[model samples]
Structure formats: structure tokens, C-alpha cells
Target: MPGSTDERRAAGYRPLLFSIAYGMTGSVGDAEDLVQDAFLGLTRARQEGTEIVDPKAYLTTAVTRLGINYLRSARVRRETYVGNWLPEPVVLPTDRPGPAEHAELADSLSMAFLVLLEALSPVERAVFMLREVFGYGYAEVARATGKTEANCRQIFARARQRVAAGGQMIAFRSSPPERRAEGEQLARRFFAAAAGGDMNALLGMLAPNVALHVDTGGKAQAFGKPLAGRLPVVRLLLGVFRRAGILGVCLRPAWVNGRPGAVKFDADGSVTGVIELDITDGMVQAIHSVANPDKLAHIRLNPNEA
Candidate 1:
């Protein structure tokens, strides 16, 4: 294995595989599974000595095919998904030097953008992502998804129109004076109070229309569905924090879906929960909480543990 070129090629599959799989399956868990399968496919192809001259191109096509196939059936499967199905939230690594490249990756991974993609038909989504996110030409996208050049062009145009027509607008914008500050202050106050087990203070921060959505994928313990209204949200969070205990959880500012976000840290300062807030008019509109154990693998602390 010292100088094997095959090993190097295999190592390179993850970046493309992750992109394709994530574009296909909005769920990070599903995207990860698909990436594993893509690697396995590459491995088996190598075992048979298929002589992949352009490894990157081959992996791209293979992964795209797999993703497109999955998308063709994903709608049927997702119909049965519990609660309002949403894309998994991720903490994007932004240390990359090239601003354009980093921004593209970060933009593609946003929960807001992914949610917008949900409205697109599976084939349309594939064409749009392959063309837009990966910088593939219409003909190249066509080959990857088994569509004609004309069809790919049409789909891309339609997707562009949809985006321009506001079906897929960026969920948030550059924070202006009318937004961000007051909203963040309120969220910080609420999170601080909740972490301290102060129900009264927590309730005071929530708006009358506050809604909370917790996603644990049923594999982790969390609110089963989105809880709506201030009373319901406040009550639910109260029960949650009361049981979770005061572990000195602190909320730190973060960007989620290009919007204001916060991370909850345990007593030892390990992130445990990542919350995406939908703020309107400086009031908390909606809350999407990601506490799935699998999703929180990067999280180093437990809310139940100090």
C-alpha cells in the first residue's frame, strides 16, 4: 500500500460522494450512509481492476447515479417519515482560505437551502444540484442522471425560475438594525434562564407565537413533533430543561442556514444542542432543535451529564 495509486484515488472519493449523497438525501445520516456505499462500490470496482483512468470523474458519475436512483424512491419513503421532515443541521467547517469555495460548500449545506430544495421534484433537484452545486454542465448532469441534454437544460431553467420566483429564497439576510440584536438578546436570555432552570424567565422570553421543532429521528429522545404557540413551547422546554438538569448550558452565537443560530454547551463547555432560529420582526418565529445522538456525534458533552 506504500505507493499504490488506487489507495489515493479511493481516498478522494469522500468529497464528491459526500456532496452527491447530501444533495440527494437531505438527512446527514442518509448522506453518510450513501457515502459509505459509494466507497464500497469504488472498492469493489478496484478489486475487479476496472482501470478507472479518471477516478474523480468516475466517482462523480457513479455517486450521482446512486443519488438519482435514491431520489427516485425517496419521496415515497419520506412520505412515511414522522413529523414534518427537515434536513439535518450541520456545523460547517469554515476555515478554508478560498472564500468563494468555502461559501459554496457552506451554502449547499444550509438547512434553509435544503428545505427549499424539497419543493423541487426529485429529478429537478438532482439536475439543479449537479449543475449548480457541483458546477457540472447540462450535458454532464444529463449523463450523470440518465437524462437528455435538453431535459437537463429544461430542469435547470425551471429550477432557476423557482428560485427567482421566491420558492427558494435565502431564508435570512444580512442582519439589519431592525433584526438580530433584540432577537439574539431575547434568545440569550431565554437560553440562560432555561439552562438555570428558571421557568418564569424562560416563559417571559418566548413570543405568543413561538414554536419549537425538535429533530431526534426517533432514535434519540426529543419532542416527537413541532410544538406550536408560546404556551406549548415554553411548557415543553420547561419540562425538557427540568429533566435535563442545570448543567450550566450556555448559548453561543452561530450561523445556521445563513441565519442567526446558537449552540448549547454543557457545564464543561461542550456543545450539545444546535438551535436554528427563524426570527421575524425581532421575535423568535420558529425553533428547529437538533439533538439527535447521531447528528450530535461531534457534540462532546451530554445535557444529562454535568
Candidate 2:
């Protein structure tokens, strides 16, 4: 439960609200902005002498609706996006694991899950996230979205189907410590192969039909379209790393979106890019690369880490 004062309550609930907003919008910047806006709305409402019987419910509704509206307006920009769009990666520290405040929803934070969410409509996404990811009951979901319980149920069903069709829904459960450790180990080998230019090892680790999706926002260097098939992806990766090596770039393994991934750093310790691996059954299914400086702006790294 949150504190009695509006400001204290907002502070206490920020993590929960941030998880919801990030899940809904798939953009860290947008999520933070939406949370701020929601709190501002709460303050204004209180100033107007409005009674807030349940601060949690009121804030949840405010953030969810703001996310819905934000997504509705962002669709146009997304449609016109120059290259494959990827959710801004949520990079976490690998050495010091933090408290699991919203760990139950971690799977939904993955790049794969967030990408599938793009297939859904604004309200549909809201209803589905509230019910599925957060475990909110139909009644609670309806209250948040201003819809009837029946409507919320129907929306959730439809959204679930759509997401499933787009791709498999990541289980809502948090990854066990051993599972996460295994993923980090695999990621280390994958990046080592790439950096060392060991094509054979890389090929062995990659799924046969693995695809490479890069988001450069047409503002940086990247393949204009996604590259499919193992050989091509491996070739491209080797070539990129070969070039990167010459430029004195290094890889620092980290937990990306709650999965194993790495951050790329330049000679001066600046973040140049991020790589998130979608591993399934001991094979890399997809390689998601984010090089657009705008997207990497939020990523912080210690240069000596690598």
C-alpha cells in the first residue's frame, strides 16, 4: 500500500506505475513521461478538492488511460518509422541483481513480448496488460480502462489471440536464478564467437531460421530491412564485429529486458549500441540490435566494465 499523502503515495507506487506504463508503451522515455503526467493530474485533482478514495486505483487509471491515448497518437509515427522499430531496451546491472518489485511481469518486458504487443490496439493492449501481465481481475481491468467487465474480458481474449498469433506469449512467471544464469552463460559464448570472428561456433549456436532485426531509426548504420536465415545473419554479425573491433569497440554483458544481452562501448566509454538475444531451446532465435543514438541515450555503462 502507498502512503497517505498524494506525493508519498506517488513515490511509493512509481515502480508499479512504471512497469505498467513501460509494458503498455514499450518506450522508456514515454513511460516515464506518462507516469509524471499521471502524478501531475493527481495533484491537480487534489488541488481542486476532489476526493480520491483509493489512490492506487486512481493513479492506475490515470496512467493506463494516458498510455492508451499516447499509443493512439504514436501509431502514426510508428507507421512512418524508417526502419524496424524496437522497444527501447531496459538494461539492468548484471553484477548486482536488484529487488524483484515487479518481477512477476518481467517476461512481458522482453523485446519479443513487447514486439508482439505492437500488433494490438490501444485499448486492447491496456485490457490485456492489466489482466494478463499484472493479474488484475476483470473488474479491476474494467475500472482502469473505463469499460465494462464483460467488455474487458472480450478485449483480453481478442488481444491474447492476436499476441499469440504474432508470437508465443512469454510466460508471466519470473525466470528462476539458474535459468537466468544459463542464459547469461550462453550470451557470453555467443558474443565471444562474434567478437573473435569464430563463424563456425556462431553458426552452431544460432537457430537455423534465426533473424536479425536492427533499429537504427535511419539515423545510423544498419541493414535497412531485417535479415533472415542463419548464414546471412551470421555473416552480417561477423562483418559488423570485425569492423567494430577495428574501431576499438568492446562488449559488456548485461541483463537486457530481463534476458541475457550485452552493451557495446566505444573507445571513449560511450555506449554505441545494444544487443538482445532471444534464446530458445539452447539456440539463438533472434538477434535484436539497437544502434539508434536516440534509443541508446538512456543506457548508462562504466567504460572499465568490459
Predicted candidate 2 versus true structure: per-residue lDDT over 1-306, tens digit per residue: 224665665678888898899998888788889989998888888888888888789989999999999999999999999989999988876776433433423455788788889999999999988888888999999999999999998999999999999876765446777877788899999999999999999999999989899999999877788899989999999999999999999889877777789999988889988888888778888888898889988775675553
Model 1: worst 10 consecutive residues (lDDT sum): 93-102
Q: What is the per-residue lDDT of model 1 for residues 219-255, given as tens digits with 9 covering 90 to 100?
A: 6666566688877787777777776565555666655
Give the Cα error of residue 85 in candidate 1, in Å.
1.7
Q: What lDDT, from 0 to 1, does candidate 2 have? A: 0.85
> What TM-score would every model get versus the actual structure?
0.65, 0.93
Candidate 1, residue 1: the lDDT equals 19
lDDT value for model 1: 0.65
In model 2, state the lDDT of residue 156.
94
TM for candidate 2 is 0.93
In candidate 1, stretches whose alpha carbon ends up further than 4 angstroms from where it belongs are 1-6, 92-107, 162-168, 171-213, 216-260, 263-272, 278-286, 291-306
What lDDT score goes with residue 20 in model 1?
Answer: 68
TM-score of the candidate numbered 1?
0.65
